[model samples]
Target: MIASTIKTQYEGSSHDSVLYSKPYSKKIDTLNMPKGYQLPKFMQFDGKGNLKQHVTHFIETCNNAGMEEDYLVKKFVRSLKGNAFDWYTNLKPEFINSWDQLEKEFLNCFYSTRRTISMLELTSTKQWKDEPIIDYINRWRSLSLDCKDQLSETSAIDMCVQGMHWGLHYILQGIKPRTFEVLATRSHHIELSIANHGKKEPITDFKKDKVFAPNIDKIGKKPAKEAFTVNTTPIKTSSTPIKIDVIKDSTQIKPSF
Candidate 1:
């Protein structure tokens, strides 16, 4: 009666049979662990943080340690703790055959819907009047990580442009979506438009149909002209202009001195 009562307390559960219900297939079970192999403690998942990040960390650790394929399926469970360990303990015995199957199960059990990126947040994003186009695009890129739908570069750029003012929107709408230089060049145009949006812009007062050359500020205000000292001694002069005689074949100026 006592045995039956004890069975009733934990009945219909794997906890009643053993501490853990391993799910390794026959091939995985027959593979012997390498001599002096140690359980890795470099990282552990507690079923609370990002599941994808945990999986990535686990894979990276396995690669760096040169762990064999069978060792990977067998040794990964040792890194779990608390809730993660509890989940592992309940896995069906003699069922898991590969690392991929175990990882898929782990994610299915712990993946949180709250962590999903909101489409509303990505779609409703608006660039502030003074915010830079690069900053706006970068913001979109950053948010794409958590967005529920995986956003493509073209879709991201289109969404970001929708929030921008017409000045930048026009230039960026159909141009190179991922080019940082193009975004930078248009950012100035957006900010300038925003800066001058509501006020009367200052006019240069230039008349139409007349071209005016730019005036250089460094030009002197007046010519440096001064009266020169003339030679007071006068020599006798011929009324006719003096002429120089030259040989037809010679083409050189003769010095009068």
Candidate 2:
């Protein structure tokens, strides 16, 4: 009646069996168990030829308690994801070089009080299903109307373009991105466009016509003013009279008689 009560209380659970069942496991020379020995405890030796106590204990414990191998493998894989490799290989060099600095800059750009990049930077060592880089970027802000409008503003585009320029530089050189050069180039373009966008007083404004003549700024000579010859002398005329002698004088004398 007592055995039946114990059986009823413990049931068939492994924990119950380990605690209540008679000690069925016997300590044998686990080091020299023959091939035919049924359920012989397995053992492992370290490089120094010493038998590891933990291995023997764990095997005996698991066999006594009925632990399976699949559960052990799952736990192992989870551990490898955290400790196997450095996570920064998949990220930009600049970000990896000075994570703290980049985190600060990223925070400045974050919208909706989000810290997506910061979190990834902190947690990338763990294994996960592969995702594209931009997916990682867009995590901080949702694709809502206000977010899109904020991203479309002048300051935002300028920041993005500048960020892209530096990011490319970092990728190409495999080094930390230099903010000075990138920001300088951005500032210069902004100032130039702001100064020369619309007010037209002709400073390198050569886009007036398609075909242009060289040296248009310098004035050319009007072909030598048609050279002319002039005689400046005044004409002198004489006041002279010419007398005509009449040959009819002989006829007139005869008529007079």
Candidate 3:
């Protein structure tokens, strides 16, 4: 009757359900499974034995992140062990831990910027515009204007690497929840790099100080000399200089009525 009752109530017409089904006993069901089923029950603890909330949090977080549940579980477990796991989590932040997530995000940012800079250079240069992919990549240096002064080389390279990481990480984070701080930190690093490398060719120099000033020679000394000469000649020919007498007013008004 107990077997029949279990079959009638819980078993879903599948024998596999008996062996692998989620905990039926209320006792085991109460405790959350370890991460990725990754760590032993011990590692999740802090010095005080406050079990790390990482495992339960990761599963819920990943499901909310729109990740495949199995994949999320596997990835989380992997993170507990080594770098490969770290890489996956870094590549998928909402599903995993922070360390790898940050690294991947940073790289993604860098790669995208590099591609953008490369594309801009190709369009600007005559030869690379219609060239094959191989040609464009290979001749990037020549095609690209020397942007070194405008942006720093190191910053540009670092940002490119960061961009690569972010691109992957964002799949889990989505377009909205990802903080601007994350985006900005990535973007600023890229901009700094582009600025250091001086490679961003926006085709405009509206930054003010770069604009040319009026020439002093053309505007000031020569024009004044020409005005003076013409006036002097005309004044001499016109008539004798008129003399005027100045009278001093003695009375001063103390206040308006």
Per-candidate RMSD vs. true structure? 14.5, 26.3, 20.9
C-alpha lDDT values of all predictions? 0.68, 0.32, 0.36
Better of 2 and 3 by TM-score: 3
Q: Which residue segments of model 1 deviate by more than 4 Å?
A: 1-30, 33-42, 90-97, 114-124, 128-138, 146-155, 170-177, 180-257
Which tens-of-lDDT digit does each residue in 99-121 have in candidate 2?
23323332343223322344223
Mind giving the per-residue lDDT tens digits that candidate 1 earns over 84-149?
987887788878888888888889999754455698987888888767767776776677778878
Candidate 2: pairs in clash: none
Ten-residue stretch with the least lDDT total in model 3: 225-234
Q: In model 2, where is the ten-residue run with the lowest total lDDT?
A: 21-30
Candidate 2 Cα outliers beyond 4 Å, as residue runs: 1-154, 159-215, 221-257
Q: Residue 253 error for model 2, in Å? A: 64
Highest lDDT, which number? 1
| Segments in model 3 whose C-alpha atoms lie over 4 Å from true places | 1-13, 23-28, 32-154, 157-257
Clashes of each: 2, 0, 44
